[model samples]
Target chain A: MSVPVCVLGLGLIGGSLMRAARAAGRSVYGYNRSGGPVAAAQADGYDVSSDLGAVLSRAQAEGALLVVAVPMPAVNTVLQAIATTARDCPLTDVVSVKGPVADLVRDHGLDGRYVGGHPMAGTAESGWAAGFAELFRGATWVVSADEGRDPVVWAEVARLALDCGAAVVPAESQEHDDAAARISHLPHLFAETLALSGVRGGNLTLALAAGSFRDGTRVAGTSPALVDAMCEANAAALLRVLDEALETLAAARTALAAGSTSELTESGFAAHQKYLERGGRPSITGIVPGDHEWLARLRDAGRRGEALLTLPREVS
Target chain B: MSVPVCVLGLGLIGGSLMRAARAAGRSVYGYNRSGGPVAAAQADGYDVSSDLGAVLSRAQAEGALLVVAVPMPAVNTVLQAIATTARDCPLTDVVSVKGPVADLVRDHGLDGRYVGGHPMAGTAESGWAAGFAELFRGATWVVSADEGRDPVVWAEVARLALDCGAAVVPAESQEHDDAAARISHLPHLFAETLALSGVRGGNLTLALAAGSFRDGTRVAGTSPALVDAMCEANAAALLRVLDEALETLAAARTALAAGSTSELTESGFAAHQKYLERGGRPSITGIVPGDHEWLARLRDAGRRGEALLTLPREVS
Candidate 1:
């Protein structure tokens, strides 16, 4: 029989993981710091506990897999508790960023038992009430590995991701952070800025926004607390990507101001078309390259009004 | 009986207008410079003619309403032709910018018979084949009128908008341009710039761009020729709005750099929440005031973490 899985923190991600595990016919236990989430999970017909120590002890005794799905600020405290109380069980996490968590596991001498993970999926909603068993279906879940890490723990994490209906993508923690900054964090920042701009334009702008404005600013509607925490955690990486984006925007503005917008317009159209054609898959294989040569290729293709590259399908 | 309508130019907007008018049980005639759009409209069982003079003569003879639905570059030529051939018929045009078209109507001495119009609706796709009778359903069709303009013509335009299942919003030509700059043109510019930035981030950014990125940059996927024409026509107004948007973005960036992002975050969240609460309607009535007091109010609400204002429902 497969090992029992204990999920700590019964928020959206944690609750959804437990639900998926239960649906897959695996034994699952849930724990939350608050009595409300714990009671709610129990009401949902899942085994849950509010007492952290008792849950950790049960996990250790059952040789269970422990999944930490807390917000970033509470991650270290939970990790410390796990190190002391559930050291014998395999551990993994579902957090947005992996580098800091990976460092914490190494610092606590728990690297051998811990696998850093991030499921690249979410909606604007949160909390246990907003979660469902199929939240991670067809999602890409990144599993971070390093030298001296336990291969068995990594395998178990990948298996768990598959069980949750997610595709497993293995990478180093730093690689995941860089990619996350570019694709996820940077977009969130843009959405926030765009939202502010829309507000400044007053009501008419909002009324006229249509599909693009709504889509562009959708993430800005996320909780302010969550936006702050995520941005703060990855400030440096987000800044780097923001700076790059600013440069591109400035260049386009310059081209527009100079009455030579054709080049910029062509490039924008080409890249956007390519993005649609690929169905939103990453253009390169493995980790994203720092050089960004694909951008130049897109601009050239746009200028020529032809497709120059064929994007590969993402590995499921 | 309601006046028969004749639609010049059988592109997406023109074809859709013809289809909508026909669906409303109003007789319609379609005309195009090229044989292709004419033949396509005819195949759809629409009465179409390639001879512009014959169509305009018939429209004037029958006192039928004439709609000029063409791109910005071709608008003036069509206006000139209508001025000479169909001077007695009421005229309206579905162009993106209203100010220039209004000016042309005055210049052609057709102010009494002409109304400037812009329906705030479209998809990335274009052309006769992409036309649908319901394309304008629930959309806001802005009708621009000036003092001393024919009230009958304006009422007929509103009737036409209603027949297309769209709401009629009346405003001055310049007012329509200003509002369009903020809500429509500004968003399109931002989408293009964001698309360029995504291209620069390489394949990973594109792949990782889930809902927000796709939604934000959706307008960038529009046809390049159309993008160029629209931006060029509204360059001054668009640039003014862009400058305002850039200032807001700069402030947010500065806050982030100073490690004090709370203010920006709060404002973004407030605006976003308000956007959702209001169902994306403009908060104010009449012409959106030049001074944006609502933004400050949103920021204050966000800072206090309370709903301090109720957004007004949009007038249909």
Candidate 2:
């Protein structure tokens, strides 16, 4: 029998979970503190509730897997609410920077049932209105199941991510946090930094700004509170990455100051080439056969990723 | 009768100019030191020449527009060649940065028929093979026509840019350099800096790298010589922008260190919200207006831009 699924928060991630789970043939329920999202979800034919007791009752009745898709700071509050309900069913979360939330979970003693999961995909957009059923499609959904997590809970959470069309990316809690820091959190800092510099530029300079600024600083537009929570949650790892980035910038600055276009260009190009050379281990390795397929997809991702990362296309 | 065109270099930009102009109902001719690009242009059914006398003969024969598309270090050599040809044809260049080249023209007393032009577009890919006929379409072709350039020459140059589907943007030499520094040049430095920092991380950290790192450093992949020339040519402006970027980053760091999430988030969110609020600018606007029916295309471009920059959609 299929386990039911309950999505907490009803924001972008939460709403996505509810819709995708339903599409995957699971009985899905949604819980949000506000009636607006719940009402909207309900109108979309979802089993949704604003009341905590009612949500718990639905999850309990359906033997659902509880997904905490709330923001990092609010994870504890939801966990506390869940603690009172005494719902013993398996649980998981979609919080981005996981260390603090995992620590919070440990502090509250919910490790047995809760798995930390983060889908490595998002846009600057947020909310129930922004929710789509296929947001996690072909994206890496990192599931960080610590030693204390129940195997059954782990399997169910993995299945949930899979059902949502995401690759089940398994990791240790610390590993996930550190990895996110290198890739996700630190980029935000660079982006914010890049944009903040432009704020002081002349109005004409800012107006004449083109694709690069927009692409380079895309992440700076993300939620400040969330970014802060993320950075604070994963401070140690983020700082290390930041140091490396600063050093790189310093080296580049020195090179630029020296006026060697060839050397600077080669250095920059070499770094990018190195990145393409040492690429990602995709979340869905088994969806296709052989490492070649993985390479091909990674290459495709990199190519398309270029359009997203820089200008859409050259002006021709 | 129109003044003769004498394109001094037969590389990608010059070759593309010959092809695009011919296609747009204009007579075209080209000259290259090496027989290679000129040979290729001739083979591609355009009028081109390797012999200086032959190039002079063609320029005097057809009296078409001249485009000097060569590297920064090579621009003076081409100007010297132009001196030797002693042709009265109106001339312009497709150089990336124009200040030094323009200065060289004035210094060498070749500014009478010479106007500085830069087609603000190209790929990391270069060479004759990389020269597409439509490369400058929808691109901003900056024409830096100083006092010495004849008005008739300026109008013809503008007409060439228009024929090639480019917007004729006018700016002084220093203004163009400064603008390129902010829009074209600084982004490269930022990208390089980000990539260099990212690649220097520990192996474990590098393994965890994701979209943000990739996006932030995409421009780091371009040819180094080109980047170097850009940095060297626009040194003053590039330095100023770099300092500004560093300051911005330092401020952001300070905010982060002080746990000022509100300030960080406010700035970050405001940046993104402004992009969303601005609606979307057409990708092809400055490149291919007037010559095409662009309303529907512009609207679509705007929609995609909005989708890219606006709020992140919820994935369920």
Candidate 3:
């Protein structure tokens, strides 16, 4: 039988992971710190509770994979429990950043079994009702293939991602954090500034705001506390990318302030075209965890925009 | 009978205007510079042709309203034709920027009968096949109410916007340009730089890019020449707004580099909430062209997030 899955928190990401794993025909259950979401998850006939110790104890007994699915702030408390109770379980996480979680895991001496994982899926909503079985469908799940990672547990994490309908992207913790800073965290900063600038333009400007403003500022609607935590956790990588973006915009501003149009427009447009062309053009070959030189092969695949499902791999 | 509509340059905005005006039961036709789109428009039963001079002469004879619908580069040519052929026709345009068009109209000495109008609607797709009668349904159309404006021509332009199923947003030429620079042009700069930065992060970063990247870079897919022209024409106002955006981002970068979350996050989030609240909230009342102090009243209404459709106005 497939190994059972245990989720630590029943918020949007955790609850959704529980539902998605169960739908894949795996024995999945969860735990919530609040009574409300626990009752809601249990009503759906899944094993869930407000008891963290009991859940970890049961997971240890059943040899189930323990998935830490909490916000950035709560990850530390959860890690403390796993250190004493289920330290040998195949461990992974669904946090937004990988490096900090890796740090916490190492601090707790759980690094031997820990593999950093981040699924590229979520919404602004929270709690049990907001989650479903399809949150990670067709999404990319980044799993850290750091040096000395156990082949067995690496394959386990990758297999879970594939079963949950996500194609696994093998990356080192720092590399994943750097990429996330570019593609996700930097965009959040832009969205926040863009939204505030529109409002500052007064009513007419805000009224003239249509599709571009709406789409560009959509993420700014996300909770400030959530955005703050994510940015803070990934600050170092984010700072590098944020510098490049500012330099580009500053160049445009300089050219405009002079008597010329932006020098960045033509090349920026070409880059935009290249981005559109890259979508769905898979280049990864046969590669999987546990194979000789698998981490290097997987990193090469990621560079070519390949995911696990792009080619067949022997999971057994 | 209604005043017939004469549109020049049968591209996306022009072609769609021809279809939408006809659907609203106004006598409508258009002119194109090329034989291909002209034939396609003609085959679709639109009265379109390659003869700009002939169309303008006929519009002069029939006392029709002339709508100049062309890209930024082509506006000057169309305005010159209007100067000699249809100088007395009630005139307006649907170009992306208003101040530059107003300057061009004044240069042609057609300012007496001209009302600068811009319908806030379009798609990336161009040519006859991309247009439909429903393109302008429920969109906002900004009509300039500059000082010494003729009330009769103003109302006539406002009437055409109303018939196209767009609510008239009365604004001065410079005011409209300033607002547009904040909400539209600055965002284009951001999108262009953003798309380039994501691609610059190398292949793995580009591969991991998701919803935020997609939406943030969507407008970068627009034609580069077009974006350049729009930004160039409104450089002064855009310069002001660009400074504000850069200042905000630089502050963010400094804070992040110094081990802190973005100081802009909280205020930016609140501003986003206000933007959401502003949508569909109307306050304009008893205001239209030719009424005493109508321009000031409309400006005040615009500040309250109001449009012409919010209350009744006698058009005739």
Candidate 4:
């Protein structure tokens, strides 16, 4: 039988992962540090509990693949419990930023078995009740494929992502973090600033707002605490992109003052059209684990816009 | 019967105006500078032509209200035609910015019969085929109420807006320009810069983009020439808001560099929440055109988030 799945922290991503795993016919269970989601999951007839130690012990005895599904702040405690109770189980995480979580895993002496993952799917809502089995369906799930990482655990993570209905985009931790800093975190920052400036324009501005304003500022309405953690954790990469965006914006300001916004508008429109042209792309295949150049090939595929779950391999 | 409407330009905004005015049972006809949209409108059974002079002469004979629904660059030419042909017709415009259009009207010696109007609604699409009669349904239509302006023309423009299923918000041209800069132009600038930066983050970033990236960059994909003219026409107010946005973004960059984005995120989230709380507000009424303080009261009601279309008034 396939390895049993053990997910820690029953928040949106974790709870959804458990459900999707169960839907795929894998033996899946989860743990919640809080009592509410635990009781909710229990009532829903899922295997769950608030007892961290007991959950880790069960995972150890059953040889379950332990998934770190906690928020950034709670990651350390979860890692510590896993390090003490289930030290040898294969591990992965679903945190937004991979580099920081990888570093934390290293600190907790769990890096040998840990592969980082981030599924690019969410709504404005959060918490346990806001999740569904389809949250990751047809979405891109990035799997960390850093050099020198254990190949067996990498296959396990990729398999789980595919079974959860996500197309796997295998990337190195730093590459994933850097790209996310630009595409994900940077947009959150812009949304926040736009929302703030629009509101400060007073009641007339609010009354005049239409589609562009609403869509531009939509992500600013996300949970502040959640936004803060994801943005702050990838500060280095985010700062690089922020500086570039600021430079472009300042140039737009100069262009506006000089009686023409053509230069910025033209380039910006071209870039936006390029982004819009990325739909319905075909996924690449043939790369597989247990090959000498598998990691490099997988990462290259992801960079070239391919979301291929690697060819089936014998996981030792 | 309502006032006969003559629209100068059969592009999206102007064509939509002609359709909506006719749908509201007004006697509406239009002129197009180009032959393509004229033919398309004619195919749709619209009363449209490429003969600007003939259209204005017919408007003069019928004493129809004139709507200058051209882009900013074409405003002067259309106003010149009105000055030469239909100089006494009550005139208004659907251009994005108001102050510049008003100044152009004065330059063309057609200011006496002019009332600045802008329907705060449109899609990213342009040209005749992209418009429909329902484009402005339930949308805000800002009608300029500058002091010493002709009240008769203002009522004509406001009445047309109401008939097109839009709520009217009256303000001075400069006030409208200022608020438009903050709520509209600045967001466009932000979307442009953010889209440019994200695209530059390489292929992996583009592949990883989700809803936030798509929504934040949506308006950036609008027609670049249209965006440029609207933004460039309101340069003064746009520059001021752009500077303010830059200041906030610079502060966010500093916060991200300093290892905490809480300050920016918290305030931004609060601002976004405030914008969200503006739905279903009651429209303030009892402000009529013939009252002693009608102009000031209308402007006040607009600033207080009311979009009452005003009470009916007699026109001499």
User: Per-prediction interface RMSD?
Assistant: 6.2, 6.0, 1.4, 1.0
Clashing residue pairs, candidate 1?
A283-B203
Residues B121-238, candidate 2: write the lDDT tens digits: 6766766767777987876676663444565566677677877887655556666677677666777877876666656554434555667887888888877777888788777777
Ranking by DockQ: 4, 3, 1, 2
Error of model 2, residue A205, in angstroms: 4.3
TM-score of chain A of 1: 0.84
TM-score of each: 0.81, 0.80, 0.91, 0.95
lDDT (tens digit, per residue) of candidate 1 on B127-173: 89999999988787776645555656766776788788876555566
The TM-score of candidate 1 is 0.81
Q: Could you tell which candidate, 3 or 4, scores higher by TM-score? A: 4
| Best-to-worst lDDT order | 4, 3, 1, 2
Task: Provide the TM-score of chain B versus the true chain B for each model in turn.
Answer: 0.85, 0.80, 0.94, 0.95
Report the error of model 1 at residue A83, Å. Answer: 3.8
Q: How would you class the docking of model 2?
A: acceptable
- Pull out the clashing pairs in model 3: none
Q: lDDT of each model, Cα atoms only?
A: 0.73, 0.67, 0.85, 0.87
Best candidate, lDDT-wise? 4
DockQ, Cα level, model 3: 0.64
- Give one digit per residue, the lDDT tens place, for model 3 in A1-316: 6789999998888998999999999998778888999998888888999899999999999888989998888999999999989988989999999989999999999999988799999888877899998999988999887887877788878778888889887788888898998888888888999998999988888888888888888889888888888899999889888888888887888888775654778877888898888868374556756778988887777767777763354665
DockQ, Cα level, model 1: 0.28
Candidate 2: tens digits of C-alpha lDDT, residues A1-316: 6688888899988888788888888888878988899888888998888897778766766677888888877888888877767458688889887777778877777776777788777766788988989988877776664555555676677678878887655566766676677667777876776665554443323444567777777777777877887887677666666666666666667767787556556776887888778755432223221233432442243222210111112210
Clashes of each: 1, 18, 0, 0
Candidate 1 vs candidate 4: the TM-score winner is: 4
